[model samples]
Target: MFGLQACAKAPTAAADAAKPAAAAQDDGGYPLVTDVRLQNAGNDDGWLMYRRDYGSSGYAPFDTVNAGNVAQLKQAWDYTSEFDMGHEAPPVVNGDYMFITTPKNHLLAFQASTGKLLWKYEHDLSNAGLKTVCCDVVNRGVALYQDKVYMATLDNHVVALDAKTGKVAWNEKIHEQDVGYAMTLAPLVVKGKVIVGVSGGEYGARGYVTALDAATGKEAWKQHTIPMPDEPGGDTWPKGAAETGGGAAWLTGSYDAETDTLFWGVGNPGPWLATLRPGDNLYTDSVIAMDPATGKIKWHYQYTPNDTWDYDGTNETVFTDIDYKGAKHKAIVSASRNGWFYAIDRTDGKLIYAEKFATATSVTGPDANGKMQTDPALRPTVDKEVFTCPSFLGGKNWWPISVSPQTGLAYVPTLHSCMTIKGAEVSYKAGLPFLGESFLVKRDPAFPNQWGSVQAIDVNTGKQAWTFPSELPWNSGMLSTAGGLLFSGSADGYLYAFDAKTGKVLWKSPQMTSGVLGVPSTWKVGGKQYVGVWAGWGGASPIWGGEMAQDPKVKGIPLGGHLYVFSL
Candidate 1:
């Protein structure tokens, strides 16, 4: 077993005074991140959000570190955080400062070029019920706007910090921490509002997305992921199940500037066994399109209605234009947890194409209207066990997929595993897990010796273009570049750069201290381009997927919190 490193001490006043005067001058006069700024973020100098842009393109336009010269890449700098738990937050880069959050809600800022500690803000959450968090204690990342950096905390609060200094400008509580409500998703700044979602789907917490005033920490609007009795799609839920019906919007969502709509994916329903909740359970496993200004649902598409297999639709949704049926269509594509890759019309929430991205035996395919045609025999029952493909983690999870306009393919980080699920009786408790099912996950025999894959799918045809396999389940999110490089980290601790056109591995780094689970980001500072990713491993996989986590294939991987930056 790997030992945990001692936490790094916070910089003292004397160390701050000894810094060079030019450190402050490094601010590059970055403009306020508005809708226009987010739309053009691919060409921007810094990584601004979770997926680096509002459309969630995850493509960096910088070309200084191309495939030809990527072999010469070296570690420019690294920062080890204090916490040893999951360090999944993608470093948010602005002008000169880069911001990141770690376990226990510790936020740190560093010099973008030198990795110098700027400041740290440790939030006090003594009253929070940390045990209620279903997965490992983790924060996805942060959002940046005018001069304030927005982050959702694990204790159900949204905080705005001064980007220059790590001081809190305002803090507002969004939900009660002890009631199975927490925030793990990065707050997204959409049209001057900080939009965030809640976690605790396992605890039967009713999920919702709330928009807070960016300038002030006041609530602007709130939209429940589960519908009320009088609302649309309400009849899908049982008489009173909507009160605790889980539809957590826990992953960062994407935006469409052209339509002024926000596309957010919803998670699974509570009491994991569908037999307990009954009905279709509206909005739980669905993608909702809402007006960013008013938080009104324009339309929604449910990926897994009556989801019995614990398939959550909280994966990131990528918005792009694709040629569908010999015509160009604005599409929202998702590698769904139910093992299907779907391309829906972003303008009207109509399915343009749907196909399997992973092995899923429970469903034959989509029906004429795109609803999943679930195999009733494969559904779990109270008295018997049912085998299902893709496990509960789905074909993918919160780890993001990148849609590269350069290659016209969506690079998906996928897992090839299945589960045997058995249902049981479960009672709802405020701060306890409401899961009514037990599952054991294992790698599918068809994919022997391979549990992870980075698949490049052609968006136009909804087919796999190429695939790169890994021995362990891939946990890292993807970052694509115009320089013909696709970057993804692995559970084995190596950050790999693959040729975007083909799945050939161009360059890979020596194994680091821990596995790489965080998303990768790229930015340019001082005329030099750098790629950065967090190296730490601990998420839902280790906590929930027992067999896969303890598999001898990945026993060599370690757990530690370190940010690695590489440059050519």
Candidate 2:
């Protein structure tokens, strides 16, 4: 047995709206999931995946709770997780059961309509995985296939659980923990294959995404993000540099079902020192579009070439159709840690528009080839310390961006910060951090008083619509809806709803147990739409936010986790 039935909490929120959801649950169980259903998550009633759809839009087409009645939103129910390190998992819903993962790979199942606990599966972990975790011990969430719930554990094992009984179906070890590889991504399942990536770029692990048979848990194919000595990108690096070149695909990627393509973002190159290996690193700090069936690279677009500031391109690439300059485009966008909001033509992987969404001052040009030109002087060096905007924590880190097709704007969870960085000498070890750079996170010089913002950008125009400033880093993931509402959370402990069009605060929930670091999601049950988000303060924020983390305002905030659901 992978799990022992857990105890439930009191004061459950009755599903007054369960009448409409009766049609969804066949036999009073989770609705049978299919590839077509996962592709149509935008039109569904449950928060299905990390972004709710293949596009990673994080937008739901529910209007029952719109901007008009948002102010009346109240807590429907809440659940406290077993572990409190970082509840970074969003509530992945299917029928009446919702799922979340706390730090340390503990999976919690819940009654979606109420706050009752269903079952909790505590993953068995070896101590080695915790040694090389670059950030906190966090698991993003889980993926639900036909009947199995899948999660990648911190020890690099992908476990498939019976969605109903919480029993272990199969557990596959993706990689050895001793080599410094770990799995924190929520598995992405499509066409019967579970796709997941590894995290250990800082530990010199060459990154890759593997596809497994969803039902059997057998390996299908694996494609590495960093190329080898004989590969096409071999010439881009020095001799043998590709061995630990560092292009970890650390986050869950977005998919385009129509194109049969998988878009995965590659992280920063090894050592964070351009002088170690020359040329534009082929896929590091780039987005690679691959064939889902074979894991073959179809097209790739580099965001920051020769990245030396730890500016990872490993942020989610969200798909949203947009009208740009009087022409409609099938576009994919990303709010990168480099502090740039980029809109790309998904069809051919070309840059449509790239605009600065936060404090960014290290690089400038994307030339005609869609390549970023790095500012040589601003880059950190062995002997020179350089101050740059959007620090390594990023203008935005792994916290996701949400795009609303209704408004044609991307709601960006942003960090208004900068850093002073310098290069350091590093040697590759089997299971050690290889970040050959030193950085001290600081406030953005342009906005000295503010550390973060909810930046809404017009995707079509590559222009800013509005921004909501914050006293602390707004590291929570964002959600947009057909309700004309934008939802996100704050480091100061409030879950906020803003008018998507004008950046106006529609509702702000009372302070929760801790800071909101998990992504916000929306699902409909009993015809009533509920907003779900987890609260916890562990990520790269407090761990890597140097000077800023020590500030009186950010220091000693809190450290715990809780799940909150709100409905009007």
Residues 214-260, model 2: lDDT tens digits: 99989999999988878877677788888888898989988888889
The lDDT per prediction is: 0.85, 0.85
lDDT value, candidate 2, whole model = 0.85
Best by TM-score: 2
lDDT (0-100) at residue 274 of candidate 1?
Answer: 90
Question: Which consecutive 10 residues in model 1 have the weakest lDDT in total?
Answer: 14-23
**What's the true lDDT of residue 304 in model 2?**
92
Tell me the TM-score of model 1: 0.95
TM-score of 2: 0.96
